[model samples]
Target chain A: MSILAIQNLYVSFLENTVVKNVSMDIEEKKVTAIMGPSGCGKTTVLRSVNRMHELSAHASVTGKVLLRGEDLYALDAILVRRRIGMVFQRPNPFPTMSIYDNVVAGYLLNGLRLGKPELDNLVEESLSSAALWDEVKDSLRRRGAFLSGGQQQRLCIARALAMRPEILLLDEPTSALDPKATASIEELLVQLKKTVTILLVTHNIAQASRVSDFTAFMYLGELVEFGASAKMFTAPQDKRTEEYLTGKFG
Target chain B: MTFTEAAKTLLWRQSLDKVFFGVICFFSFLSVLPLVLILGYLLVKGVSALNWQFFCRVPQPLGEIGGGIANALLGSLILLAVAFLLAVPLGLLVGIYLAENKKNWLADCARLSVEILQSVPSIVIGLVVYTWLVLPLKTFSALAGGAALALMMLPVSVRSTEETLRLIPLELKEAALALGVPYYRTILRVIVPSGLSGIVTGVLLSLARVAGETAPLLFTAFGNPFLSLALFRPIESLPHLIFYYATSPYAEWHRLAWGASFVLVVGVLFLNLTAKFLTRRWRVRF
Candidate 1:
């Protein structure tokens, strides 16, 4: 079943419309990759799902994003964000917080109280799910800034997973990492789809083909193609999708 | 040009650079010389007057010896505490507003006003506070003195807080917000903590700036001789004590003045060094 449905989504910042009349459905517990070149508005579409697009000054989003048949826009924005976690292109763990505190930051920031043992378990489970528990277990009290770039990104992932969100939105999460780190993150994404729906926006076409169960190709603020990843990669229906897949143009 | 001519020109430029470096180093030392000289002079002149009695006993009558600035010390502490309470919260809020709304017209206006307030003379602030609080209350009180100093501290704290918060990247705030934190909590919990060291440095520097101000206390505190703790009554402060004793004609009073000056200078120096240390030690790495 589809967990999220975007209907006629249009996003604009001031006078420029960036995401125009885009519509797609995100399947539950599946990796859905939004593939496009830079400035193609795939990130904008991902942000609109969690209502983060409104943070920009003069930005306006018009669309009905239904989360499990409920209108996401009609729901409280803060609650929507809580149910749909997001990670940025750059790894931004809270610099002031230690790794253990970062894992429970969602609860801490939301003013939710939990017992110590419960919190400890939550931190371990979340970190383990993000594949960072073993590496950082002994040094959980250290600041997240002390971690390497790849470790920081995993810490951010752990922080998001701690909330147990229904959907996780990633905006070019591996673009800033080295090749080995990118491979690890890609491998982790494949493992993560068993529990949470993943909506990944990537400029790298090869990355989309590698890990995504489904792919949506966007070009110049329009959704050019949406299909199963295997079918789309082998035989793209749209000329633009074929061109982008063949390295004819980004 | 010939290679020899070019080489000669290069040699001349190198000499000019060396001369410029020497000139800068000389002027830098010249600027720091006054502080060193003042500290040395105060130590030489004030050391004899500093004793256990000078710290614990009230000032003695004009011809007698063995006195202390106990009243002034306590009064200064009270006044500074009051001023810190009054200024810090309001200044931080204003600074956060200014940093968040960098392009807003009202924020621009507020920033300009803070700059102007910072440059206003301490004596003018004293006069204004006297008219506002002292004249209406019909008393020269520590409360009035505190209010005056708070006015002086506001601009410094506000500017520092704003500049410190502005140095934090927008992505940090977004990170917190993406976790479903409310806007105010994101600012208070994430943004403020990230810039905490810088904010603390700003607060300490402002406190140091007002700790030695005498003109602002002259009309408000009024320099009492007896030890009193009431906020509504006239009180003595170290700066006021130094000002009064330094102007008097007695040798004993001059000694007391030097001791008080030494104490005040040391206190200010300690605050400045603490600020510098915190800025280095507690700085958040991103």
Candidate 2:
């Protein structure tokens, strides 16, 4: 069964329809990739899944999103967000916080003061999982902003994973990293899939195909085609998908 | 040549730029010269006057001179302590309410009233407090002076708290809320702690301003040149004492007033400096 599903999702920006009638399902422990051109509502769809889009004053979304068979749109936003964590395109670790604090920020926010051992284990596990433990362990109390962009991005990912949400939503997680950092994050995501479902948004079909099991092709806020990643890349059913895959158009 | 490049190329001493810069800087220096000279003079005069006995000894009565301002020192401390106790929490809460729950009509009205209260003259505040507190309570007591200083303190504290709270990033609040913490708890735990330093700096800066207030104390804490411990009884304060001795015909009192002025200025300046220094050191890593 699908761990998260969307139906008839319609998002509007002021008077403009950015995403219309978009729907997809993400199976548990699987990586699902959403790919489209810029301003094609790819990030909007990602944000709506976690209800992050509702933060905008002029943006609105309609229809239902179900998480683990429960109606997420009808639930409390705080509850919905707890089960569905997000990482932004930028490395937005709380700048004022330390590396250790950034990893287990979820616990602090929930008022669960972990003992030294518990916090140490949590910081160790999350950082190791995000492939950042080796570099940041010694300087755990150092500010999060002191990390390089790639390291900071991983720390952000580690922060989200610390929440232990059912699924993690990444909005272009590696876009801000260097090629090496990007490759490492891509590798980390491959390992991360065993723990939690990932809904990754990327414009790079190659990266999407490398990391995702399922790929959904969207154009102009509409889902053009979606299926097994290998098939979708090699043999798409729609002309727009073929044009997009072959780099004929954005 | 482009208009911008032409302007840049022609920027020389003969241009209006140099003349304007010199004129503006000259007038600015002129405007600030008095304050600089006064502070310089006070430092030179006061440093020599600050003996241990000057602190330990009590002010000699009327005709007497060359004694410590123990009564004035203790009174200033009491007045400031009481004023801070009254002002801090009340101003902070009102500021937080104005910041967080900016629900159109009510918050707007509250903010507007706070602005008006902040702009009111200290003498008027003294008059108001004297009538309200002293008339009803029957004396220019510590409570009455404290009430006036507290009134002056409110607007500053509120503005500071509001600005500090606003400085906290919105993402931090969202991150807390997303973790299933209630909105109010998130504000109290995350936002408040992060904003604490700036808020404290604001309070200290305002407290320094309040300590220098003479007009409010004129009608409220009027100079009682003796050690006072009772909160409801008449009290001595540095500003009022300084004003009293400065205006008196007695040479002894006049020298004491200048000495007292030196002490008051130094105290306020020291508190303001320490507050800023401590705030810089108290930053949170986590």
Question: What TM-score does model 2 achieve against the real structure?
Answer: 0.86
Q: In the order shown, what is each candidate's alpha-carbon RMSD?
A: 1.6, 4.0
Error of 1 at A130 (Å): 0.8
Among residues 3 or more apart in sequence or in different chains, the pairs in candidate 2 whose N, CA or C atoms overlap within 3 Å are none
Tens digit per residue, CA lDDT, model 2, A1-250? 5898889899998999989898888888989999988888898999888777876777888888988779988898878777878887767776567889889988887777879898889889999989999999899998887788889889988988888889999989888789988998899889999999999999987899899999999999998888889899888999999999899988
User: Could you list the chain B TM-scores for each candidate?
Assistant: 0.95, 0.88
Give each model a TM-score. 0.97, 0.86
Candidate 1 segments exceeding 4 Å error: B1-17
lDDT of 2 by residue, B158-263 (tens): 9989887877767677666655567777778778878888788889999999999999998888878778978998899988888887888987666667777899
Q: What lDDT is obtained when candidate 2 is compared to the true structure?
A: 0.85
Instruction: Estimate, for each residue in B1-286, the C-alpha lDDT of model 1 and write its tens digit.
Output: 9999999999999999999999999999999999999999999998889999888989998799779999999989989988999999999999999999999899989999999999999999999999999999999999999999999999999999999999998888888989999999999999999999999999999999999999999999888999999999999999999999999999999999999989899999999999999999999988
Q: After superposition, which runs of candidate 2 have C-alpha atoms over 4 Å from their true positions?
A: A11-19, A57-62, A175-179, A203-210, A219-221, A239-250, B1-32, B47-49, B101-103, B278-286
lDDT score of residue B70 within candidate 2? 77
